[model samples]
Target: MVRKYSKNDEGVSAVIGVILMVAITVILAAVIAAFVFSMSNGVSKPYTVGITIKKTTSGAVSIVNSGGPDVGQLEHVYVTYQPVNGAAINAYNGEVPADGPDTDTLFDYIEKFDALKTVGGSFTIPAEGVGSPNKVPPTTPTHVIVTGYFKDGKQQVIGEADV
Candidate 1:
């Protein structure tokens, strides 16, 4: 009498199914981890500060801080005057003169704002000596940029305008 052996493939199929499930779970976890890490990098919100740019009757440009919740955290401020046909002048840390030819009292104004961090902090770029040696000219539009530096080592452009 010849006896035929029955094939026992049930155990092999169960093992393969378990391996497949584990592989899928690992792949899903990796995808979710990557997404979470990528999103976490941009979790910090930018500070909000109100800034206003106004044109004066004397052909000057004024940049003012209108106050905000984050104003108290502001450590320093920088002002840049870029004329249409002249080199850019940067005012920061009392570098610009209070009153002199080819310069304005921007540094003094900014210094006060940095110290006080109050609303209505303003600086003016004059157009009186336009085309002479002044950085801002009335006839030609000038671009003004105001940057605020925070105590947390964050820097942002608080205001910008062409006047």
Candidate 2:
């Protein structure tokens, strides 16, 4: 025998079911997003530190330094490689003769330390260990310090470079 259905319960259960389904979907999406973000960072950042000696006949790769009064603007560009233990804030790792804390200091440090050598975004090995006068191979360096003033985001390096 069929039982009598209540009018009040008819729409309420349907709405509750729909709401529960939406909530579950949102929670799962959030959890998935968090996991993916965490994993992506590991893929991007290096686990250790090592200099990438790129074999380029055009004196390796360097940035075009200039000025634009703000970040994201391509201002002064130059070549940077390696780091000094007790080097000054504006000091160059033997890359440039006249070393001083300039606006491009952070970029210099970031480019040098960043293991993600995609296109023109990493340190270069000049003819010699010293980043000056333009040297060549045999004198090419393998290690780099890559020191920055503050954490900023340097902790990203989770590994070292094979080169």
Candidate 3:
């Protein structure tokens, strides 16, 4: 009688397969968790607000909140005035509200709170803000650029109007 040698390798492959499946599942779960957490902590939707720029006969520029979504706690507003025939004037900063409103005032307050406006809010650009020491003659052919900054460091070009 001859003695034969047998190799018992049946369980080796099954063990490796199970381990690989478990590792893949763990990795997938980790990826999904990271995505969910990031989404939950990300920035929310941006506030919508409309602005209008106009020039008064007195040569002062006006920024009006025509209508739009309420932007809570504005940080600042910047205005750029470009006269049709003259150089552009920059570096005018807008004022923020002293406090946040309890209810929606987006369209209620007009110009009383500097650049921060409720709907229908209107702000007049002072002569000094426009880089003029004295009364500057109002120019019809001018472009008024208005920008609004929120507390979140996000800014929007509220409006650009030619007057």
Candidate 4:
């Protein structure tokens, strides 16, 4: 006797194919949802401002705002001077030592920068004894750092140079 095979198994295969397709669609939707939700967190970006620092022949350090999109957002700028042989001196709001006439002059420049946050703004910290006391010596290289405070309560080191 010869046996005959029929197409009764077709229904079973169709059912499995449908289940597999549904599973794949669910997994794809989940992946996409996770990606979409993860990017909605609010995070502020840092300000981008151009700054230039240089040491002049007179042994003074000059800081200039080269102008950038974020320059208008600057609220104040602070300068920190680190000499090769002494403790770091910060010139902000009259923080420099008052023992010398030069320090008083340096403080004045810092104050002016803080007041005027304009493009192409520049200030010079005079060499030691000239107007800045020994904090910035002429013979020794000093590290000058300029930090900008933004109106959004963010502070960043805008520029640094060895002068």
Candidate 5:
């Protein structure tokens, strides 16, 4: 004798299992895509940084402001330095405070005038070390790095070799 098949509760379980699997798969795929997108855009962007330092009798260091100042604006602006044997050191930093000053001045004092106004368009301090008054060599006690953040929401790394 052959057993009779019914659509009562047998094959229904299989169908339900398949449906659950498909739903779970779809949810996982969406989560993965969102994670990847976040990681990609969260770390890459354009920015500008400025560095100012007192010029040695030899090396000529200048700080300039390249391209910045947007609506999103650099929410935060700061600087850090890499020591001769340690990690980067936080040197100087300033902020525009959204509804604050137009120009965020950093390390602006070192000589007869504030270098951040005149030679700060380039956002870099030219150096070759010390002992020439024009080139900063590779043997100085003081060195610095300047980083900039733009309203676009990106971090920029700029440095002014030995100071």
Candidate 6:
């Protein structure tokens, strides 16, 4: 006696189930990867800076980076002078030298004046620029405001001193 076999489709559901599971797993993995990368590559926060100011008899002002963030992390240093009895003005606004703060001694704040490049580094305020010596003369009580700028254009008032 010969036996005849009947065709059946019972395995179709198993194959489709496997495909669906694989697709779901792939999608989940992609989403997780996106979240991980975004968290790891987020923008950096701004840094804090510490500075010291000194005024000379000749009407020259000097500054030193006392503490806070490293010099290489800064993009520029901004200085503003506001006389007690006079209008406020900008003393200096210049980019930090790409080479870093000059190590040579600062004879006067204006001598080899470099924007504060390094911590414990110093620079002179010249008689030039807007709100500078020409406008804010020495011997007058003034408020000096120093700011540190980041490469991203964010800035923070790092130091303030009355001279």
Candidate achieving the largest lDDT: 4
Runs in model 6 deviating more than 4 A are: 1-46, 93-114, 126-135
Task: Let me know the TM-score candidate 5 reaches against the reference structure.
Answer: 0.35
TM-score of each: 0.62, 0.26, 0.48, 0.64, 0.35, 0.49
Global fold similarity of model 2 (TM-score): 0.26
Candidate 3 residue 15 Cα shift, in angstroms, is 40
Name model 1 segments beyond 4 Å from true.
Answer: 1-44, 91-116, 129-139
lDDT (10s digit) by residue, model 4, range 1-163: 9998776756558789999999999999999999998887766687888888888888777788888889889987877776778555664332444342244455355565673267888877766523323334534587777878788878788888887
- Ranking of all candidate structures by their TM-score, best first: 4, 1, 6, 3, 5, 2
lDDT of 1 by residue, 1-163 (tens): 9999998867568789999999999999999999988988856678888888767887777778898899988887777666677555553331333332132554445564463256877766565532324333533577767778788988788877887
Q: Per-residue alpha-carbon lDDT of model 3 for 1-163, expressed as tens digits?
A: 9999998978668889999999999999999999988887666676677886766667677788776755455665555566667555542423222342212533243223454446676767664444335333336676766667677777677778887
Q: Which stretches of candidate 3 lie over 4 Å from their true place?
A: 1-46, 57-59, 91-113, 126-129, 132-138
lDDT of 1 at 66: 90
- What would the per-residue lDDT of candidate 5 be over residues 104-154, giving only the tens digit for each residue? 343242221223323343333334422233332323455555544444646
Q: Candidate 4: global Cα-lDDT?
A: 0.70
Error of 1 at 154 (Å): 3.2
Best by TM-score: 4
Candidate 1 TM-score, C-alpha based: 0.62
Candidate 1 or 4, higher TM-score? 4
